[model samples]
Target: MRFPKILLIPVLTLLITACQTGYHLTNQGYSRVQVDSLAASADSGMARFLQPYNQQLGQTMNEVLVESAVPLNKARPESALNNLLADAMLQYGQQKLGQPVDCSHLNYGGIRTNLPQGPIRIGNIYEVMPFDNQLTLLTLKGSMLREFFEYFIGNQAEENALIVGGVRVTIKNNLLTSIEFTNGKTFDPNQNYTVLVSDYIANRGGGTAFLKDAVRRQDFPVTIRDVFIDYFRQLGKSGKPINPTTDGRITIQ
Candidate 1:
């Protein structure tokens, strides 16, 4: 069947323009909004329609990563991805500092989103931590360190704030013990320990009341985002197998 070429051109153009226009509506002459009631209704609507999909998407991504990558012995799939990221930060810090940094900490809330499944991407990391928090090194006395551990245990359930990098610790009967590092090293109280943790951790935001009393603290010139990006790039360059599993970095005894 022969088609009318002239009529088809005009019809196609109108269809394209209509699709481009979309369905956006502008309210003419906006006045004061008594939106407290409307806000509540909108929140409830979102909870009903959007919350389930978001949770499902997170779970799906987690599963995809598991299926796509060779599982590592050190990964902790049950815990949040923030802990895994904190471990990477600590590893990078140890390489640069020329000494074993006691721990690396990142706030649970700071990890805004879950890691996507399948191939890991830099954009996913950005979505997880949208903030510009930088890495900070802090030195605290032995007593202050003990207090820091105490603070961690106190709010362990309430806030997922502190993730110990380069170290493994257990809380037993509300007491901290059985400390170890990724390289099977233990902490020395007398030695001046360098901690590679977030600036927020040094500021005591993660239930650490004693962080304010740190003896020596300095913020590194680089942002945490830069650290993660570099880590990912280096992994690609070295062809080192990337595993998203968690070792016994943070544990409950």
Candidate 2:
């Protein structure tokens, strides 16, 4: 999340220009301006104007939220980073709803970067989950839930397209052979279960159109980034470092 000094010049120029323009300007054809060594020496006013804002942004982004015991990287089927995010969503959902959540999930593509093994900063979380996707709660019959996974299994390519928590899935030959809840409860097609997912998926983004048919759905004002921040802060408060590990939540044979 480190902002390069060179990139900041163009951004600062835009900001200064915007501030100077008293009226809205219509967009027109744009051309790239080279920001080489010559351009670097040309703008003392812009540099002065950008200094404070840049410093403030840097301070905020660099604030340490928590520490990670191990480098959390994303991987197909299952990985420590995926497990950590899914588990965070599940725990946060349960706390927010004041009830047990059956499961939680996030699209693998949503994770943009990996966290290093040491201090996790606010910027790191922002880099990891850049989308402003909000958390959404959905209630679906077990049958509908099965359809959700079926779509995932059928559509997934070389990469693991999904990360899930509180549910174990066994896939073989591109088929979902079995699914079990970690709570030791049976998945009954007739029974309804609560699921936590991003608003993007609930709205049928990422090829999950079946989610639009959920028996019940609720959108929260919370964003996924904020949820991770809260979770990390809570861990910091408890004197715990992030040390997530894969638990075979999703297996392929």
Candidate 3:
């Protein structure tokens, strides 16, 4: 009472200090590590369950596609899927290189798989062009074209060169006699023709030695994977189903 309200200040400060709570923090701790289940982590397990179903589904879809789509044998001269694939490569190559890509070709063996009869998928194309090869464009003159023809004939005279949109030929008695185009245009020997093709062929790995020429005038590096992707996407958009049919593109006679 002697110092009035000032006397109570010290007591209040002490009381506040005493009322504070303390946290008992610990330096050591325990952890419960979680491990993924066997089913989730094992790749073999996933493949074991999925492979059979994928094949069955592929087979059924292929059957359906074969029934509904246009047969290759009946398709117009350039309407075959193989031809279309080659054409797509040529177009892509031309756009990439800023030049006229004259023609495109693919080996029959390289077209390893066929389009299925039912629902076609990206996986189907992967099976068809499974290698990690790139698209290449070769500028060859008429003389080189003749050499290529000679080489191909020497290998398999009966089988015609599998070209896409720009060639007509007749094989006779194991000799390449007449080669023309749908437009009645003949291949000029002096004019340089830009051939859009696969890198494998350009490297002469696919049994055609003409591709081994020292002069690879220009090279456009493009992967076949991208080609197939674009092709599949277009097919899906158009709902234009395709079938595995043969044409005189590679004729026996």
By TM-score, the candidates rank as 2, 1, 3
Stronger candidate by TM-score (1 vs 2): 2
Q: How close is candidate 1 to the true structure, as a TM-score?
A: 0.62
List residue ranges in candidate 3 displaced over 4 A: 1-79, 95-98, 157-161, 182-185, 207-215, 240-253
Q: Could you tell me how far off, in angstroms, the CA of residue 237 lies in candidate 3 after the best superposition? A: 1.7
TM-score of 3: 0.60
What digit string (tens of lDDT, one per residue) describes model 2 on residues 1-253? Answer: 9789999999999999988947676876979998997777757898899999999999999988888899989987789888888988999988865656899988777899999999999999999999999999899999988888767676667343658888999988767788899888898989999889999889998767777779999888899998888888787776678677889888899
Q: Which candidate is the best by lDDT?
A: 2
TM-scores of the candidates are: 0.62, 0.79, 0.60
Candidate 3 local lDDT, residue 124: 64
In model 2, residue pairs whose N, Cα or C atoms come closer than 3 Å (at least 3 residues apart or on different chains), thus clashing, are none
All candidates: CA RMSD (Å): 18.9, 15.6, 17.3
Off by over 4 Å in 1: 1-80, 97-100, 182-185, 188-191, 238-241
Q: How do the residues 117-195 of candidate 1 rate in per-residue lDDT, one tens digit apiece?
A: 4555666656666778888888876556656766656664664434566666776666677656566555666555667
lDDT ranking from best candidate downward: 2, 1, 3
Q: What is the lDDT of residue 104 in candidate 1?
A: 70
User: Residue 94 lDDT in model 1?
Assistant: 76
